[model samples]
Target: MRTKPIRALATLAAMITISSTALLTGAADTHAADVHAEGTHAADIHTAAPPGLESLVDTAVTGYLKDDRIPGAAVTVVSGGKPVLTKGYGVADVRTRAPVDADRTGFFLGSLAKLFTAQSASQLVTEGRIDARADVNDHLREATVPDTRPGRPVTLDHLLTHTAGFDSDLVGRNKASAEDVEPLAEGLTTRRPPRVRAPGQVAAYDNYGYALAGQLVADVSGQDFPAYVDTRILRPLGMTHSTFAQPRPPRIAGQQARGYRPDGASGWTEAKGQYGSWSPAGPGAVSTAGDMGRWLTDQLTADSAANRLMRQVHYRQDPRLPGLGYGYEEWRRDGRTGWFKDGDIPGFHSTLLLLPAHDLGVFVVFNGDGTDGRAAVDGRNLIDRVVDHLVPARPATPEAPRPSADPALATYTGSYRAARVSRSSLMAVEGLVGAVTVEKDGDTGLRTTGLSVDPQHGEQRWTALGDGLFRERGAGGATLAFTGDGLLVSSATPATAYERLTWRQSPALHTALLGFGLAVAALGAIAYPATAAARHLRRRDPHPRAARAARAAAAVTGLLAVTFAASLAAVVSDANAMMEAVPLGSPLLTAVTVTGTALVVTTLGVATGAMAAWQRGWWNRTARVLFTLTALGCLALASMLLLYHLVTAPLTWITG
Candidate 1:
């Protein structure tokens, strides 16, 4: 680890802090903007013709949409609080062939819902009801931090900043987020608690935390979170079409664009499935581009009190990244100082950008295609170019000092075991002391080096909470506690406590697991001989049903073969953890182990049934047993390889 000291500078000392998202942390996922050019010429506002600007914008937007094969787009340009251009192109619904127009009802905003989160949060701040710096534990009702660690409490500021130290999984739990989108009670409790960095520390993006914030809004405002937004921010701005519609809205329900993966992967089969309860966190909101344009106009006018609230940059931000602050439902980016958000789901993608300084904004929606190919980035860039043509740039702000490293935190570092029962445990060992390297999966570990000892998150001692529960300060991020019977707990979620097992990697345990997998596979393979004998008998009888069964078996076998091949490849070439490594190595360990075993078990069961059916044939029974064993052998190899990958591979690197 580097030993250089990072002394905070006076000019841009606080600005050097790490960031989760370019905007506020709890805000929704959206696109990022780039550097702005300084404006030289001025005073063209009164002219009938904006001088090459309209043609350039129209050409850029039209060309991009046509080239990208976008289904529909809503382009609106607001110049100095006046609607200069508002037009819709193409169709919102391709199946029904409905053309998207200015009044094209409702549309899902994807992660753009984060902007509303910020807005809702800012309203609380405006009323002096919630302090941003106060610990969030104080505000939360259904869920609370079990034991508040020393230093500052996990404040609203921390949650807003995404420096609260929760892992990304805290947000990505599909079931929980979807469930949370239900009425607040069901939706709020579904989320797994977070464990990563501590509150008010380095940045870690958390979408789930924002969901929690929405719940907090409900708790504080004495109104539903979405309703409050409509009353406070939306109603004031005349954003009539926009609503924090729970689950979904009826207006755009039929026209809503479906979400998709990178390919034609069979994930989302419908335009609208369940986003779970956390839907309010993101799924609840719906709006049209024309309405969004009105919202943007409200934000950039600067004359309205709401717009002033939107432009105030609360966080000390770096100029390089645009819109990196948490204000009253507003954020700044690229020195142009604007408000923006984007939404994405299977077949639909939407973006809304509002540049306050230039009174220019744009909204786009593309539906039907389910692939995130060239169009996503190109579409975003095209919007920026439109804004660039209209907005004037300010002087370049002073850049923050180069960040440096801290070395002391390297002391408390080692592998910790986390059972499915408790939070994971960390043992401070000397050899691996340079970096606090924890395996995210068996193959890959997230290494954080050069940490300083702070009394808040990191002190020099470990305190036992009770019942084998222990809490350590110097560890950072996770809590170490004892629960019962020589077992230690180390999980982040309070709802589900995980205990650490002493026998993490005993040779005997591994051998037993491997043996179990082999046995199951063997058992299944053994049925093949009996199956063949049964087939022969059925063939003699000329049973059409038997023929159908044979075909089904063939198809299943083919599919299983493909699965086995993929599993084999993973076992051989992929690292121990195909994704992130958990304490047991890779989650694939469980998948392969269980799936292989199940296959073997099913084969064995079939073979036994076959034996009962053809009691007269010795060769049939023998062949069945042998075949079952062979299949088991194949599965055994795959299972062992899966284990090896979980234990000895690198991170899947999906995010990077």
Candidate 2:
């Protein structure tokens, strides 16, 4: 699945929390405190600034990098269209012991590359080559996006705002070797995902939509996506250190930071970078802090129509949520309005935030995969800390009008799912297995549990803020409100909206159904084998034909159980292996499908035999009941497999 950037950052934050104490000790030893102290005296080294702001940022970044075991990072803070602090910290290459240089060390921008792609599209709009509100199909030269909802064509505005209804498609080939990547058009055609919602409706963050937008850029410009971006945006902005090329160019090879992941110990391991098929959507650009500084300056100071369009608030994801501009996620917090884009791949995390109100731009990137709970850094939080130091939090607002006690509040209780989830693939496991549970806490407040996948299971108490809106109590609290059809849980960005689900649509129900099916099928699979072995030892044979049918049923159920277990294990052990296995036509998935088919057929015979034995009184009531229930369990398993589209197709959980 194309993991949402917020979820990825949440995972990293959770990991950072695990080893904070020990990591902080290491950070102290790295003279991070001294760096903060030196920042006060070294104002002449950069530019004139507030006495403590630079020190605060230095302290924050060094501590984060050290505590997270992130090998290196580059940070740039732009004020008044000038970089006041552009610095690199720690080693870029562990074996070579190459120190990072802020101006030179290139970092993979990950999904932040979407900003550049959006800028390119804005340029097309400025040139009158494309219309933001027109149907996207109007610009396509190769494969057309199917209009899943007739009369509602997806527009460039939908793509820019991520309101495009395309389902998440993350199964395309991601090559560690650039040569293995196919053309953008070929990749999109091969892995085009089915649209799941009406265009211009619910905002689901679809990277594939950006891929289509890139294609549109190519179609109109008569140049490839990268070349157009280079000629139109990068060259104009003088961001010379950036390139939207996979494997990077030879000239900048040595300047690239070596990506790393935690080795499970207090050490790091090299993580090779990879390129996915939809590189243009994001995860294709590599650039230096210096280049990003230039880019941020352009965003703040440029007067071109394209730059103006890029900053326009094209879509409000939800009336209750923040608005999304052409390439930016806009939010109003602490009386300050800001726009930002977060990016993440396997071994890198990047974020760019622009507070135009404050004339402040913050860019940060880390070199770590953050898988082992040791090398995960939260760049967003770091930016927030720095911003807080520079621009103090706004004063509290006065109390609002008292909320009405709605008698219908109790009716709102139920499990809710995120709108941005994979419904057609195994990635749907995330949506189908976990859901946010909302229940009434009192007449004026509500309690929400299971809002995350973490085992700790954090719960929030929401007090009514009038109308249908509820505000979470305490610092950094979220706001929740109900739409006409569903609930919208507030997020840092509008892209991560939570969609309420009906009881019938709850993942809990599906989980319980699958759990019961697995439990009963397992009982039959084990009991029949044990019973047959005991009969053999006792020299007692039931009717030969019925006995054979029972044994066949047992064998098939056993195979089904084993196949399911193995597939689950493969996913848990190495998720990427399962992902790679999907496009290649996995043998394990085929085995599971074959066994499930046989179980479905064989269970019918078991049911028939059990019925015959019951009618003939060949077996006791206990044995007959057990056999019948077992057969029913087997049938239930088969039914579930079919219902969930797991039997005929590759198990999405295992493959995706």
Candidate 3:
């Protein structure tokens, strides 16, 4: 949490259920007739406009692009298997002054590519090439999944629903260039993330799981992942403008849009660092808004196995929690149930939502993260706007507190960190900074802080539903349930689960301990030099060697402590950059490693020196006491460094 922007997005996400599920159940022939009577594409707006909806979209988009400084964006909306609006906004390339074209400009679809991966696997299920319930390794030829859980192998269903329990791993998953991209299986086999949870136990957004799914599709189909998608999925769906290829195919290379970011002042800079080995996880896919529109319509109408899977909930943490269906995240917003898939890579961000109940869908993409990541916020806001206009949510009835406390409240009360964080590596630091606190607010009502806080209210209020379940105090909100195994899953964000954080892993304790140590270090750092100068001028020595040795050890400890803190600050300042891989070669990472090691070594020196001081009586009692505190502070600093695994030969934030 770098402060303001993250907090804002968190507020919006918690309130919007940006937070709830489905543009899909099935599309009937009647839907076509209904749309024909209403309208078709944006072109039909003048003849058969949906009143002021088009104008609202245009106004909202224009304001968002300008205010957010988004250089380029593409939006697609489908209603009843027809395009309601398919358009582009702003310039795709600022330097060329090139305007974006919905049918031509290809935008990266980050994690949204996971939808295609799910579809491909579902296709195999339809043909009996693979069983959805079988072990994922059953179909694999080149890449094999280790048996992390005996008798409960991860299935294709688990992969699609993000219930496979693969620990998150992004570092080095991407290559700097298309030429550097390796074969799918080879890339997946290397550095595969360890399974931290059993299959279907908890859901954590996993790029590696999709990568594995893509490899399975490839092995069974005897085609590359990209080729399999293009031939079987894209071409069949009339998504001719989309491809999972790294370098765009010659047919669409010239038509591709360049993703961008703000140049800080007013200009736009090309965003880079987005090529990877995993074609199925979304880093390799690119599509135009028009193509995405077609895909949306097809997803809502198609009678294929993938479509069938999309129509039903494959996984829900709680009965009231509308979780994941196939690869799409499910939600219930404004009395409209919808399924949405969002993608994000460097320079590109996209969201695709399908409301099966209404036979309507929306696809949004931006070339930039936007002013403080508002593109993501605005994307959800745009969906809300559309859903609100189309189907207004009935006013919520006021909720009252439950009369009695749930017997399971104690079991649910604890600090939790998202399951998406890597526990084995240095990346564990992320969980500490982003911990969620669940507290018993009243007799039976529980307040969740930092997990899913409502924007209007500071924290989310929930009335206990007994047996470890919680219903939102407000209407149009998510349901939360604590699993028997200490995992918290919500209907709002089904992509990930929160695992209980142990007391030692608590950031509150970390901050307090580190602050105390750093304070002592800071004082010692200045005092050592100042006092040394005084001692030299006085030209009086009563045990110069002993006093000097102890002072030197404390001084060295102080220096390393400062170095560790400064380096850590530099690393965490931009966490988005570290997602794919930690910058192993960065001087800052090296500084942390070196300083941490030195700090540990010097702490030993300080400890030895502290004892020597006591035994030899190096100074007056007051000076001796102060030095002891200094030694304890250095010891505390060392313990924290070790606790965070910062000195683990490899740094946590760095891929190295």
Candidate 4:
């Protein structure tokens, strides 16, 4: 018994040592995996975002990039007024194995740099150096505003407000180089007579107007517009990484992502779009997420005179739309207010959103213009989602639903709107599916999709907590709460909620449903004949049991073929619509059809031979081989489709 206890003790000690070794080894492997996952090969680097926010950030980015097959993307976010999340995802250059980084990622701010130009203009007003309403002519010597009426010469206010009636697509204004500028008067005449409404009658967003605004900065300050912004706006904010250099400055190195365009048949090919040095309104500035966060912090500092100046509602109406108010460069979207700007070009799509209401900001720069307007708009919504999560404190009654007596919901329900709203929150309790539509004229309409409210998700319903406040879902999968000021503020994360309703449609949606039905019918017609032929041969075969098996195989093969064909057709239709051409025979279509046909042929051979070979050894062997080949082929084709859909398909509306 003494000897037995000693043996037991020794065994216990050994187990302990083994357990410790296993844990240490496991830990080392995990650490190594993390490092490798985030390692930068020079073309792109992937790093973990700050904890808690990583899933949200990664999911959003992965979906956005994969859906568009973007070569790479750089992302960052601010939490607690500090850079909490800064990371790069995907390859910067596939051939080079280069890693993307915050410091080196190069993206066109496009028109988003307008916020900087506008901020600089606002700063001048704060310093008593410029007037928001002064005659732009006073600052001009070589260029003059095109006079549409004898006495109604466009004023500085008119240009700043985008109501100068200048054409937005001023192509010639963007010269071959940023150093080139078409004469201001020249840009006006080559186009139709200026469509000048009464000055300030409508707030039209014009690239040329912003370019003119940039020019005014130059004429008044006696400095190039790019230099003026760098000194007066960027440098003051300590944004060292932001620049508008014609050729990118040397300081920005290694981590920059190359811009690309979808080649006609070449697929995702590279291109260098216009870079601005002369035309400040359009594509000129290059920036990264870390630098942009610094700029946003400076813009949000209430103590700064620049912030106050920027908040001034100069035009008091959305220059881009009616009813929405314009404050210097920022826009007032109903009760919830924020500064918003977006950029788009051949190879890039970018956006910046500053929610002054909650001291929150989000900036996104994508490698491709895949989503067009929807990407920027959706990016802002994602920020709002993050903000909501950060804003609301846990309710005291944790396990209980928010009470009906909650005062916050009542205060939030008043007629509030954004210049461009996504959804109306009037029916906050009903969720999106059943929510009533509030028309432009403020009329209520029924939800055409029917009502769908699930309180369990906390995502699809308005959950009433205490204090009259309610948690509501935002467009970006974030939550928002009604503030006492009649604004929908993010409950946890920092965000501003706008009420744009342009995405809502009844007639267009109906047509889409009808198209889907037609597509399904067409697919069934194409597949039925193959299925019938296979089923008949199997049921009437020489061997009764084998015939039954063949019939089952036929049914499965026919179903699979039909489903694949329908999905392929839908993708082709969507691609055609986007490109404005029937892509009759592309490499993409060829790949899909070739793979599907191979499977069909293999299936037919196996099903026919299986029934014939029930008692014949030779036929059975052939049938078995065919079955194995068919199974292997299916797996290979699946792998190829996954790779193509996730990497190179330019317009994948189906997956998107």
Q: Top model by lDDT, which number?
A: 3
lDDT (tens digit, per residue) of candidate 4 on 245-326? 5555667533456655333322344433345333466555778877786776666664677666555556533122212212
Global lDDT of each candidate: 0.43, 0.67, 0.71, 0.46
lDDT of 1 by residue, 328-410 (tens): 22333244555555554434456667665565667665542222233345455667676666665454457622222222222
TM-score of candidate 4 on Cα atoms, chains taken together: 0.52
- Per-residue CA lDDT of model 2 for 443-501, tens digit only, reads 98888875532234368878876667777776654567777677564655476567877
For all predicted structures, in order, the TM-scores are 0.54, 0.85, 0.84, 0.52
Q: What would the C-alpha RMSD of candidate 4 be, to one decimal place?
A: 18.9
Off by over 4 Å in 4: 1-51, 171-195, 250-256, 262-267, 276-278, 318-336, 371-374, 393-443, 446-656
Q: Which RMSD values do the candidates have, in order?
A: 16.2, 6.0, 8.8, 18.9
Model 3 segments more than 4 A misplaced: 1-49, 148-152, 263-269, 394-412, 442-444, 453-458, 463-468, 471-475, 540-550, 571-598, 615-621, 647-656
Better of 3 and 4 by TM-score: 3
Model 4: lowest-lDDT 10 consecutive positions: 1-10
Q: Looking at model 1, which ten-residue stretch has the lowest summed lDDT?
A: 1-10
Q: State the RMSD for candidate 1.
A: 16.2
Q: Count the backbone clashes (under 3 Å) in each candidate.
A: 68, 2, 25, 44
